[model samples]
Target: MEWDWNFVRQIMPVLVQGVKITILATLLGSILAAAVGLVIALGRRSDNRIVARSIGLIAEFIRGTPLLVQLYFIFYVLPDVGILLPPLLAGVIGLGVHYGTYTAEVYRAGIDNVPRGQWEAAKACNLSSRQTWTRIILPQAIPPMIPALANYFIGMFKETPLLSAITVLELMNQAKIVANSYYRYLEPITLVGAFFLAISLIAVVLMRWLEQRYGRIEP
Candidate 1:
């Protein structure tokens, strides 16, 4: 079939709308992931073995399961237990929780890289635990963590398509709707690819900026 500029034009608005949903989901999901991942990371580093082990087990369990299955459980299974989340909320939570596990590991690695002497010095100074972590450990540990966190942001963006499986009207879901309604897959699918590529390119640029900014300070 000949490429139809008219078809592309007609679907442009729909694709744009879908892109909005995609961005919103990514932003919300990333925020939640960052907050929860930090908690998990700190928990894994706790002096208490029980706290550390419990958080470690949770992070491992989430990483071990497929994100799609997690999404299904949140969207489909949880409702039976009286935890009903809207599709968008469920999608965001699934994405956040799945990637939060990965980011938690990233945080652990970053924290581990902090010089052992720093911790000793903090203790030598009689710094409280909170002061040691917030003032010394995190200030140093966080810069290296930025790149990993930014990478996860891009990964989460790509994975947003999975939300379509649960009927979240993200970019891919919107494309499916357009394709089904018009019985034309070419334009909508191609548009989806273009949208993803464009966003991925933007993300790459942003990641590089973050890397450069953080790398100089920490590396």
Candidate 2:
């Protein structure tokens, strides 16, 4: 079908709303993923073998499975067992937890990259575990992690389209709705692609800035 300016104008508002939801999901999911990853990273490093192994296994399981299946389990299966999350909330959880496993490795690598001398010095100074991590190790480790973590968040943003499977009114879903209603795929699909391309470019620019600003580690 020929491109229709009028249909494009008519659908812009709906697509804009979808864009908002998509961004909201990405932002919330990224935050949750960061927090979850840190906890998993720490847990895997725990002195308790049980805790470490359990956490490691869970992380590996998550990383091994498909994200779509996880979303289905969270959104569909949970409701059967007395947990009923709204679609958006469920989508966010799925995205966060799935990506969190991958981010856990990034966190582990970052923490491991800290000099052994730093840990020894912390011990030599008789610093508490909390104090050592907060005051020294994290400060050194987290800077270089920013670039890698930012890359994962960008990946999460692209993966937001998967939310449509769970009934999220994200950009792709909105485009599909418009396309289905009008029986014309070209305009809405093209607009959706254009929208994603524009936002992804912007995100890449921000990621570049973050890499330059926080990806460096000082001697």
Candidate 3:
């Protein structure tokens, strides 16, 4: 059968709207993940062994579970406990928490890469803990961590398709709706792939530029 250009035009607007939702989910989720990850990373480095161990266990639990399962639990199970969230909100929470665990590890690695002497020097200079982190450690750690964080942002974008499982009207969810309505899978599925490819390629280029600008020194 010949490609239906008319059908393509008809679906383009809806699909573009879906793409917007997908991007928004990714953006919001990335912000949550970055914030939560930093908290987890700092907690793991806490002087209190109990706090550090407790945070580590929590991170492991998040990282070990499937994101889809987490999404289901948050979207479906939580409602049973009277914590009803909208579909998209539940999806973003799942994505953020699930991926936050992974981002925590990346942040840990960056902080670890800071020279040991830097911490000692800050201590010797009697810098407050906040000052040590804000003025010294983070400045050194965050730059090298940019590429990894961007990579996870792209990963989160790709994972937005999973949001469809929870009834979020994201790209893949819209494609499924269109396909079911028309019984035509080719166009919508192909469009989903093309959109992901385009966005991923763009992210990779940006990440490369970031890496070049702020990459850590290598031996």
Candidate 4:
């Protein structure tokens, strides 16, 4: 089919809505994933072997399973057990949890990279564990981790298309609907690609800036 500017214009508004939702899901999921990853990392590093082992096992299970299956479980299976989340909420939870396992390793690495002397000095100063983490260790560890975490968020943004499996009206789902309605796949699909490519390029530029700012840590 010939490229139709008119059809493109007609579909822009719908696709724009989808784009907003796609971005929203990614942002929320990224926040949740960051928090969940930190928690998992800390839990796995606990002094108690049982807590560490349990958290390690859970993280490994999550990392081992496919994200799509997790989404299916959150959106489909949970409804049977009396939990029914909205599609967007379910998708956000699924994305956060599935990626959190991977990000936990990033957190662990960043934490480990902190000089052992820092911990020793904190204890020497009689700093509480909370004060040590907040005032010293985390402030140093988190900066370097930002670039890696941003990379995961970018991956999460790209994976937003998976949200469509749960009926979330993200870009890919909107494109599919438009294509099915007009019996024209080329325009909608192509538009979807263009939107994704454009956003991904923008994200790459931001990621580069983040890397320049926080890619390194001094011992």
Give the per-residue lDDT digits (tens) of candidate 3, residues 154-203.
98999899999999999999999999999999999899999999989998
By TM-score, the best candidate is 4
- Model 3 residue runs over 4 Å out of place are 216-219
lDDT to native, each model: 0.91, 0.92, 0.92, 0.93
lDDT of 1 by residue, 9-55 (tens): 99999889999999999999999999889999999878999999998
Tell me each candidate's TM-score: 0.95, 0.96, 0.96, 0.97
The TM-score that candidate 2 achieves is 0.96
Residues 1-219 of candidate 4: C-alpha lDDT, one tens digit per residue? 799999999999999999999999999999999999999999998999999999999999999999999999999999999999999999999999988998899999999999999999999999998999999999989999988898889999999999999999999999999999999888899999999999999999998999898884332
Instruction: Name the best candidate (by lDDT).
Output: 4
Ranking by TM-score: 4, 2, 3, 1
Residue 67, candidate 4: Cα error in Å is: 0.6
Candidate 2: give its CA RMSD in angstroms.
2.1
